[model samples]
Target: MSEMQSTRRGRPGYDQQGILAVAVAAFNEHGYDATSIGMLAERLGLSKSAIYHHFGSKDQILDLALDAALSGLEAVVDDPLPASAVEASAVARLEHVLRGAVHVLIAQLPAVTLLLRVRGNTEVERRALTRRRAFDRRITALVSEAQAEGALRADMDASVVARLTFGMINSIVEWYRPGGREGADRLADDVVAIALDGLRRR
Candidate 1:
């Protein structure tokens, strides 16, 4: 099967990973409902049958793309912040994770955009949203911990803080384009400053 899929239209042969990236970009640009298999084939410079040969349906591509997108956030959620950078402080850890989330959004711009835009209309979309909410819960716990430690303000509810913080980071998909005047690290720095400054205890 691999040998048979060596080349299609002088481009690729069953390159699901590469095809997934293109599909994600198209989905992000035109919306998942608007992007068609025919459009995907044209974007990938392959035939519709070639795309169908690898993916049974367009939803499969969406599933894979959502997988690609959510994995980055999940990886960040699962990671243990190094003691050197965070100094075992819940607030520091929260800041570190928030900053990292921006970098992930920048790095996986297209897929993350799709992840943010999911409407839960399908099983795949619902599953992706569930994973996102799970990540949100994790951040909320961190916010709660930070407040308990007197690191963050407790005037507002922790869940509200978490929601607003993520609201800012998630909104990046709407206006962020690659090759911007600022790098991801710089954007992370600026975003962290703005997010943490407002949340920090006076």
Candidate 2:
């Protein structure tokens, strides 16, 4: 359906996307398991049936929100490097992926935050976790290649490095505030620097 028609069909000024955003926020605030369709309806000032009109169920909303995050991260991992970076070393490509991840995290903060909190309780959460592990494997391979090329430290296990790097990136959701002291670009740069280059002086 056209955007106009979809908007008119739903509550005024609220369509599926708007409703999904509010639902994500609610899920993040109260644990997803604790949240319900009734709560989302109340938060949106609409009846439960109105919510059902847009979504099949609360699980459907969770599925969409998780996909928002997973797709962003998957894109970062799957996308080919730019022409300049295509010939770059594995470490450089790794850095590029890391920067991209930081941007995705910042841009899709709510979805990504919701994703990180998932514990594989339901089929939706399990599917997200599975995709997340695949993403991690890609990063681990890149880290291994970089180490083989003598760019990154060899002492650490590649999978461990990958997890730790993402651990730092994932931690941003707890503290990052959009339009605050730092912007996404700066945060990306800082994340790459700290993850690649050690905090101790060279």
Candidate 3:
């Protein structure tokens, strides 16, 4: 439906959020092109029309799911660091952003997994890909600034560091399990420690 399912319908049924969660999982597992409305409907136990009523198409669902992933990371980038961190050096700021990225990835693993799988076969995917590159550039700028300030090793290319840093963080999607014993904060801290230890100027 164009609106949420009525409260009278009971909580077992899927609403837009519930459906989108399933859609993200489906897309992540099968790839966006490999999935279909029929499969989503079957999984939700709702007809395709019900899904279409809530969303224009599978593309729309993907767009929203990817938004969920992007919003968290964007928040970390756009928001100022905590009071103590406000005057932190360039490398510290870079480390803060990078650590926050790991937290974002862990918090939104499923949506991010879907985002990382996008191949630009459709307009939605292309837009997502563009936004991703823009985010990468922002981080790369931070890397370059740290290098210029003599905070990071100048020998390595900033762009290479950006790619390798993200490559390692994003790789968590392949194996990191949510609600695990190690917890989000520890994982993010460990990632920051490992990534920055090698990057900091000796």
Q: Estimate every model's Cα lDDT from 0 to 1.
A: 0.85, 0.92, 0.86
lDDT of 2: 0.92
Best by TM-score: 2
lDDT of 3 by residue, 1-202 (tens): 4344545445447777889988988888888888999999998889999889779988899999999998888887786788988877789889889889988998899998988888888899899999899999999999999999998999998999999999999999998987677787898887887887854666
**Which wins on TM-score, candidate 1 or candidate 2?**
2
Candidate 2 vs candidate 3, lDDT winner? 2
Off by over 4 Å in 1: 1-14, 83-87, 198-202
> What tens-digit string does per-residue lDDT give for candidate 2 at 75-179?
998877888777889998898899999999999999999999999999999999999999999999999999999999999999999999999999999999989
lDDT by residue (tens digit), candidate 1, 13-45 = 546777888888888889899999999988777
| Model 2 regions more than 4 Å off | 1-11
Model 3, residue 131: distance off in Å is 0.4
Candidate 1: deviation at residue 74, Å?
Answer: 1.3
Q: How close is every model to the real structure, measured as TM-score?
A: 0.87, 0.93, 0.90
Give the worst 10-residue stretch by lDDT in candidate 1: 3-12
